[model samples]
Target: MSLTYTYFKMRKGFGRQPMFCMVKPEMVDNIMPDEAEQKKYCLRNPVNQESQAVLSQSQQEINTTRVVLTDTGINHLEGGWPKDIHFDDEETTSRYRRRIERDESYVDAIMHLTPKFEHYIDQNNAINMYDLFYKNMPSEDPVEKPIIRINNVFRDRQCRPTSSIGWTCEEDSKLVVSYCDKVFPINTPSRNTDLVGYLWNVELPSSPVDEFLPPVACWQVVCSPVSAPILLGGLEDGRVCIFDLRSGNSPQDISPEHIAHRDPVSALLYINSRLNNEFFSASTDGVCMWWDVRNISKPTEAMIMSVFSPIVNEYDLANAQPITTLQFDKAFPTRFLCGTDTGLVVNVNRKGKSHNEVMSAVFKAHYGPVKALHRNPSISKMFITCGDWRVNVWSDEIISTPIIPGQPQKYQINDVIWAPHRASSYMSVSADGRLRYWDFLRKYREPIVISRLSQHPLLKIKAHDNGQMIAVGDKKGVMYLVQLSDILVYSGNKDKPRMIQTYERETRREHLLETKIKEIRLKLTKTEDVGVEAPPIDEITEDFTSVESEYKRIVDEEVRNMGPGRTLSSSQLEKVKQEVRKR
Candidate 1:
């Protein structure tokens, strides 16, 4: 039939019935009206034979419709369902095709095109074959591996009665612990080691005469700078004890009559490096005494600290202040600092003939007693003080205010020490059990590292002269020996070291020149009162000869030990020649 005639016939007969109709079995359930009345009416009415035949023919044709699988369709099947079948937009279809192609695996099972009944049978056979292959596969041998077990020896060790907890590192890093009535040395090598090992220990002896009195506790201990085996300790009974590690005997207490102070001795310092036998001790008795180790029977000199008025030239001995700490300037050996319980610091000159004649300048430094004081190794004029929950840095020239103002209500600094090698870096332990390292040159307010320690607060701290180790003692008598890492001790930057060194040199020079000028002025003032006149030419010449003779005598005494000869030996002659060349 022509397509136009067929379309016209269908339009003419649209009101009566359709020539052909197609319906899928799946659509039969949905075509019935949902209303019960309508469904009943449609079911009750029956269709004519011609209409039924046309409907039946259309259903058969739909069932027998052929769907051919071409090579293109098979190739695209690997990329999943064809995109044009569902997606309408060309762009969206292309994106979906790309995604499916990227994700589809080539190893997926291949689907063969076949008759429906034959295909079903083949799928069942393939599944059975896979099961048989999986069940009969050969098994591989099981591998044997070693299991590791870790043990912590520190936690397992038994602790002593006196030492409830102990930790030790190694021999190279030595730490001294003071607890109860005994002092001991512990070697700590690393942070992880147990502090159970004690190389040696010494106990305080009881009073020979007075048994009722309590045994004195060792309040403070300091190692002798000159002798490795010598240690000086301050006792709670206002006496000083000297320990000789080499002797291996009990510590010897100084004579009762020559006791260092009337109250507890709080601090001890080796006064002079040149004279290792001399040390200075301060106590709560408001007195600081200089003692010679050779003759501990009596102090060589004693300075009673009292409130003094520079303007009125009056002294108040009634209200004496106990000295808390002492530090001497390296560049100015005669000049030393004394911090007192009254929050006052006194700058005194030790070169004076007597305590009464010594020159002193007093400053009210802190709100409470100055517990700790440390001088910067590089800067003689700068020193740090800790008292009343604050740390402040002061300059010798300006005593009215601190150069580095302390933060108010920030931290209760227990102890502070400057880095021996670095000019700007310093470390401090706070009451909160935090050890903080700060670089003042970079960020004055913030710290570089803050290490939290045990719950017990650190009471005393000391740094090794080499700047490699630091020792901290807590309230529980436990000692922590910390070895500074290379990065913490040394600066890798080149510019900072050079700049600090140059500044220190300049400051030293300026201080020396100022001291010389002061000496010259004093001499001039003395001469002014005498009204001395210039000497005669002949007298001047005579004075010059005497001065020359004095210089010759000094030179002769210095080289007096040399071999007896009118002229110097070969080595001496070479040194003399070199000196002459420099001149």
Candidate 2:
């Protein structure tokens, strides 16, 4: 009995039932033999039987061809022409073309072809099949309710606060989150406390893939965009350390205590260099240091906080304003921006050769310590600053006020970051454990989406380079990986141009405001006594520069002429002081 059949062996109750399937006509033709073969055999029963009903079945593994495709280029100097014609000769080409045009057949062809061309042209103009009918369809606004989804959650075994989160590429997407006691000075932890940080794989997110131990409690961590194993971080004790995931837990390089900051490092950023190993660190000690990973013993360069750096006495150092945050642009390597504990935003220019050459332009930014200053990647001169209870959008053009002064939130904003793709949007996490997504293009005064991701206070939030994933870390050492909606990460064609228009309109408004302020100040300095003067400024002028200088000069003279029993008089000084209002 031949046993070649596609059906399985008949089993108990259910399998005993007869199977039914429609056989395609072509399949029946393929199964049946030719007329000559059929003539040799005669079936007494045209019904199914064990051996006679067996179906022929054979498996053929598909063979793949090794197609090595080769590409070649053909360079032809000119089109094909008669042997009598020289293609490069302009005169000969023109004569041949004129002859062809003058031919009777060519003339007849052109004259008769017009009707057919017109007919098709008319048809094309009458109705275009390719034209989109739904081009004017109203776009759906982003869902009023938040669409953020929790993709993954990673927990720390030791339960340390997640200080920073950074992403880098490897065999799998890797994240390095620094774990340490964020409430360090207020509630000091003992020396024996564990300060181990974790390196996590996004795919296998149940636990950390690797761990790194810092010499001190690590506060901030950043991964190199090109290197998967390399990590740079700042410690709570103000020392900067570098770590390698391939090596054991210990840091690869750690800065020395003698040259380290007197306070914990607040922010760190990589600066482009020849070796790609240099980075800058800002600390609460009122100092910023640039370090090379290879030689971490001493900083390559250092700068004082400049905002409140000048120490007039021992009291100044004790009460000095600290540098809380830093922002740098690669395009402008000579200058960088930093925020002070006194809420001053200072832009430091390193290109100056002279020590006293106007180093920075200071802007009073906030009422409390500035927490974050993230530059708008698309808009070079604009940036957002988070501090106290508010977030404000600022431009380099306006030093007096923010371009978009947002209202204060219910809670202090801890961290804020701009969306990687959206030009007019950013995200902020507050101390109230709520994450707010802001789209200025939709509305400027309030955030569009407010989602509470954690019960604990959120420390930081970072978006992946692709703008699809967001990893937010809270105070409890829990990291939430979130998936963003398409609207938050994508922009329409008009977004960038509209953003530019908004910025420009605000910039012009600020310019007019500054001009008005100057006029107001001029009016405030006006003196009623015009001719009773020592060649004073305008009687109705705003600038008090001349008045201030003259007052200084008179005070200095009085101080220099101080005698044993002499007292200061306001007779002559009183006249100058009155003219100055001492206006």
Candidate with top lDDT is: 2
- Which residue pairs come into collision in candidate 2? 521-542, 522-541, 522-542, 580-583
* lDDT string, candidate 2, 219-311, tens digits: 889887568889998988889888887877898888889999888888899886667787899888777788887799999887765554443
RMSD of 1: 31.0
Tell me which residue pairs clash in candidate 1.
166-195, 167-195, 168-194, 168-195, 169-188, 169-189, 170-188, 170-189
For candidate 1, give the lDDT: 0.61
Candidate 2, overall lDDT? Answer: 0.82
Evaluate residue 538 in candidate 2 and report its C-alpha lDDT on the 0 to 100 scale: 70
Q: In candidate 2, how many Å is residue 260 off?
A: 0.8
Highest TM-score model number: 2
lDDT of each: 0.61, 0.82
Per-model TM against the reference: 0.50, 0.65
The number of clashing residue pairs in model 2 is 4
The clash tally of candidate 1 reads 8
The Cα error of candidate 1 at residue 230, in Å, is 1.2
